[model samples]
Target: MQSLDLRRSGAGHAILVRGGRMARLVLSAALLAPLGACGIPYGTGSRVTLSEAPPSAQSTPSEGIMQALTCMRDSHTLNRIRFGIAVHSDGTGKSSYGYEGATGSFLPQGTAAIWASEAVIRAGGLSMNYYELNTERALRQFGGSSLDTALATQQQTRVPNFIISTAFTALDFIGGPSMDIRAGGIGPYYNVRGASLEVSAEMYRPGDRMTMAISSLNRQVFYRDAGIGGGRLFGKGKGELVTGTIGFTDQQRLQEATRDVIALAVADVLASMPVVPDDCRQMVENLKAAHKARVNEDRPQEKPAHGSRARRDDLPAQSPAPRIPAEQGPASGTIANPDKARRNQR
Candidate 1:
């Protein structure tokens, strides 16, 4: 009787061991099912194809307005004015958005500088080439681009009509406004969170770096906080194992938001100019009508409302931009009537 009981006990222990392995396998399959819809399975070594995104071609919000005015007119009104992009990075190290195992800050200062320059260039305006110095020097050494370099150097050493610079000023994560929800230990939960990013830019007279106009933009960026999040777990074993979590929420569109901010800032700068073209000024007004405060906000110390036509009274009295003879305007983007443009404070 004792021998029979021992054999039965051994058989029961084997069955329990087998059952545990089956339970783990089932759990794993349930977890990995989601990944099948996302992409290749882990360690598959397969080429993964991404869903195509809408084609933007790095186009800015003001791109259409620029194309219309420049194509129809003799020249862009701002083309005669030399613009410079300068770097004064103060807030690159601070990151408002946080993700464990994530590398680098979400807000990059370099992109802002590049976007500002491109916005002017795409508008058929003049931009000072501060970058590619190495290539410029090499070309000059080979006598390939000497004439071009000499002309640019002359204009570059003088004060640019305006210099653009920006910095990320604030990043806020609001626990008061952020929402976090949970359901059954294994059931999916809905989560919503709130965040905001603020950036400010200033225009300077290049030679002395004197501040001309100041404007700021604030954007709301929300992210769903992650993790199983120290929540209670419902399980079967006296000794249970734990791992990761599955969530359902819309991913925050940070890249798209950043692009929009950059576009709006560029438009605001043009709108802040003492002599904005009628067409460009109209566009700025339309933007302000559509989206308030995203463009730029006025401060007590600055000239007119951030996105409105510049206040000529606010402009400091100074000699007008030097007039090159009509036959020879700036080396690039020749002005059809230099005198009129200068009168408008080019």
Candidate 2:
């Protein structure tokens, strides 16, 4: 009786152990099931999506200038007009973000001027002596004799017919009141910001030193956003949770707006010029061809020759089938033409 009781107790212990192991296995399986849906491939490799880099900021201005030049070329209104660009200034005389002090150390002096020069050159209707302008200070430092000698040596040192200048006349920034709303434990905050800029430009004939054409442009940019925050019961857990969100305001937008304004001003100023520079037209053609080549290069290559059904039809026709000679054969090499063999035997 004592041995039977001990045996029964051992059996019960084994049963309990088995039940515990089974429960643990089921729990592990439940936990691991979600991992299968994660889409992660087993092994050492990682997944990535490949793409090309974005184009440069200058691309916009360059493309805009190209289009304007194309229009001018088509209409046959382009002519070779010599011109020079001087440093643009903030004529407003008010302190702004970039222009802070009297010395004007913060402002970008040639931003618009350089764009205009490039536009004129790319249009193929204007001429600018970049080499002369670049070397002017150095030549002057060598004295009047050295300057005269340098000018005499140069084959082309023609004076500019007109000088172009630009000025930033106004800048304004406005901000809307920040508003926060809450409903049922959820809250959202909203606000708006705006910036306005004004620019003026003038074209002056060198001979008379008088303004031939004047133009002004005003541009404004705005940014707005609403940020949301809320809390809810997730999986019966009570814990602090934070989620990150992307903002819409990009600082580069301001620079882009400035470039756009410069491009427009350049187009307007060039329109009033008597003749477009000849070199600018050639540059336009070159830029167009380069853009075409770049676009073609980025396009996917043609499919393989065998993969294309259209090319299969374009292939040369195959030659006629070769003729096969007649043959006779047996285990002992019996001849098919037995009559000829019999004649030979006779």
Candidate 3:
């Protein structure tokens, strides 16, 4: 093999570098380096950080969404009914965070309010945006020129069939900043951090704002911060070595958790209402039946255990084709089992 050529313009000289201790150390480190997608070992710093895949905005339906959607689908009158949602207070009352106050806590008041409005709209229910005053002003201005009282009758504010109001009930800190070390005191050093968020939603008639159903839901979000590192010390004397550590962090984004709980609470309220149209009754039943069938299909197929035989009763129910007696062949459709026939007669 050709020795490496070293060129030094300042010294105006070139040296033939033979493979020695330094060269061997470089080679070993290169071999131990982490590989990229193309299997090429790449240079890295002392620390590397990787991110977990966040939740998808649109994917498989969540439990809350499924239940709410199912009921909305069955009702079919959701579009005809309007919902007024207002969640304007901090009910949790826990007064602190690293960044802000209670009302401005991790789970803010606006989160519950907006999530409720979105849930109602997404589930095929008509909802009014009562929060923005500018939009209301614009609407009023647009309808103002309908003359005066004459136009008032033609355009008027819509009444909601149901009103949804929510308040944060509780926020509790769950576990810890616990630590663990392994692999000769150099494995993962991790801690568990979680917070439980609870909120309640009240649905009511808009006429008197009379409360109908209140659904309170709680969700606990758990996350962890962990780090691990390992390195090899090879060579009798001193050689080039690289020690690297990596961090795997799962952050607690409360918005998603809050959205989930809000969706479930809204579903509960909608499910309590018996406002489903009579025409939608059959369709709802069919939808439910199809959902059940899908669930069954997704379940894993079961088989008899090893060294075990299935009994006659263990098999699925199936009616065997009955054979006719030669005397009564073709003409008689009666079952051949006399006992079964007698039982049927009785």
Q: lDDT tens string, model 2, 1-346?
A: 9999999999999999999999999999999987864666546686544577987663557565667666665555545566677776766554445543445422345455666666556555565643335577666667688676777666356777778777777777767567767675567877787777777778788767987766566666667776775654444467555444333443325545666466556655665543434354334334434433543455675443123222212323432433333432231233666766666567
Give the runs in model 1 whose Cα sits over 4 Å from its true position. 1-59, 62-75, 88-92, 95-101, 131-159, 176-189, 224-247, 285-290, 293-310, 313-346
TM-score of 3: 0.52
Report the lDDT tens digits of candidate 1 across residue range 1-346: 8999999999999999999999999999999888766765455676667788988775554554455334323445676887777663537355544676444666655546776677667656677755436776665677757667885687557656777776677766654234445464333444567556766777778557677776676677666644443245346765454545655556577645665555566666656665666556566556544454432334233333433534443556544555568634543333666676666565
Task: Give the Å error, residue 334, model 2.
Answer: 99
lDDT of 1 at 190: 46
Worst 10 residues of 3 by lDDT: 304-313
**How many Å off is the CA of 142 in candidate 2?**
4.7
| Residue-by-residue lDDT tens digits, candidate 3, 1-346 | 1233333442334222343656888887787664433443345643354578887786323663665466566556687888877744577777655564434466666545777787777667887765555654666677675544444454356656778887778888888778766674357678898888777888888767677777666666788888886565556788556576788989777756676667666765665565654333333233334433543455674331211222223233533544447646533434556666566568
Find the candidate with the highest TM-score and give its number. 1
| RMSD, one per candidate, in order | 13.9, 34.5, 21.5
Q: With candidate 3 superimposed using the best TM-score fit, by how many Å does residue 78's alpha carbon deviate from the native?
A: 2.8
